[model samples]
Target: MDQTVSTVIDEDVCIGCGMCVKVCPVGTISMKEGRAAVTGKWSLNCGHCEAVCPVDAVRVMSLDKEQSAFGTFDADHRWLPHGEYDTVQLVRLMSSRRSCRNFKDEPVDRPLLEDLVKIGVTAPSGTNSQRWSFTILPTRHAVIGLAEKVGGFYLRLNRLAEKSWLRFLLRMVGKRDLEDYYHTYYEYVEEGLMEWKQKGRDRLFHGAHAAIVLGSKPGATLPKEDALLAAQNMLLAAHAMGLGTCLIGMAVEAMKRDRSIARFLGIPDKEQTFAIIALGLPDEEYQSTAGRKLVVPRYFEG
Candidate 1:
């Protein structure tokens, strides 16, 4: 992790309120001679100091201002204070955003796709190591290209799963992943692959016009969790933008097993792909939000 301090404080404009110093996680900013100053040699570059400053006297040089500028919608640069947003509307959006399998043939605009990536990076990352990466297949043709590679992987996997001897040998070595996959997903995958190859049906992406592959470069504290969090942000944002999205776990699984799929998508060898989002104008609609499964909360009393 590069901890180089990128925080610059305009001393003349600073009110010396110490808000930036108080909010900085790495204590990079401190009050010196009744004014806020960059006193530390290192920083997380998380922009806490810049965000908390009273008079906009602080700026993190490493952070890009263009990232917050959305092409599809006007973004409010002012930060919403705690407890300011409506929770009811927030929860409504959360519950209403369903996994859409049916999508229209109309392709998503490149600007909208770019805006989605911008929305994706707004998610918090572990230790401020914002190593999340996005690879956009901006057209149906591009999406189909990736789908074909992923389909090939599943086809080969089905052949191996057909071999009882290999499955048994793997299970004997305490590796039950193949055996579990064979039992749980073999039949479904076989049917889907056949439909795809013979009838030109798309069971993988469900005919999505576009896709965004989310991943993380090496050295993040929690790469997978960070990528998933960013994925959730993009999913919800897509829903609000009049688009539907689905998490293609099978594509992610295929990529994990075969590195060539990632390479085909132009993702580097060092990065790990975590989520692939299939998105486009939805063809389906629901009347209302549905309830989830019951759950009991467990409190740990120490």
Candidate 2:
């Protein structure tokens, strides 16, 4: 394998800003004229320079590896074995799976919904243990009802424990920053409550025509893994079928605290909803990923 790889910076958006050069803790970046250049043959793969740069001008192209590591989609989702998938296409599909908080007030096709679930059923579980179950909220009414119930559960827990000291201590996380962490989701939810109930575009369920609630065995070694895989599969399948899906993280966070949620979702007492996917036919089409903060590695070697 090649010891060093090269990451290129897009000169256009670079703005000749040395943010990348300055932030490179490993001294792996250098200034080239007015542009930022990657140094050391990418011997240091840390991407702090690229991440800190205001303009998205950095590209971390891995050497001796697929150049599409930073982008590209696996259409067939063969990122794993035992499944014939297009690894590149899957990456695109997964990355494109956006958190759609606003959705069209429409219903989903039943057969297509069934097909999506079938795709999830094929996801590998822990040690091949299929301890996963799914509940589909088929109608708009039901989706709202479930979300409302889950939201109530969240507010109650929000008042519970005084505050999370560990997360705060480790990362200087404040309470407000801790709660409603996902892009004004709580505010959106609160505002959408009335509109969703009236079948308006509150998009409380992110405009999902249907939602698949995932359940797993408590204390099961692979519960979270199995549930997440199933959710991913479902999201991709929904995307492939010309539909959209969003994994509702807050729902899972709330459900983990409420033991009765499983029962509410028709899951057996032994099962818990580890994930919930909001699915629906897309109202509009979009390409390209919204700007996202680069995922920076903690440190580097060589």
Query: Top lDDT: which candidate number?
Result: 1
**After superposing candidate 1, which stretches have Cα over 4 Å from the reference?**
none
lDDT (Cα atoms) of all candidates against the true structure: 0.93, 0.67
- The true-versus-predicted C-alpha distance at residue 142 of model 2, in Å, is 1.4
- Give the poorly placed runs of model 2, Cα more than 4 Å off: 1-88, 155-203, 218-220, 296-302
lDDT of 2 by residue, 86-145 (tens): 878978877787767666777887766666666786777664446677788888777877
Q: Choose the strongest candidate by TM-score.
A: 1
Tens digit of per-residue lDDT, candidate 1, span 14-125? 9889899889888999999999999899999999888887798999999999989999889988889899999999999999999998999999998999999999999999
Pairs in steric clash, model 1: none
Poorest 10 consecutive residues of model 2 by lDDT? 63-72
Poorest 10 consecutive residues by lDDT, candidate 1: 47-56
Q: Please give me the total number of clashing residue pairs in predicted model 1.
A: 0
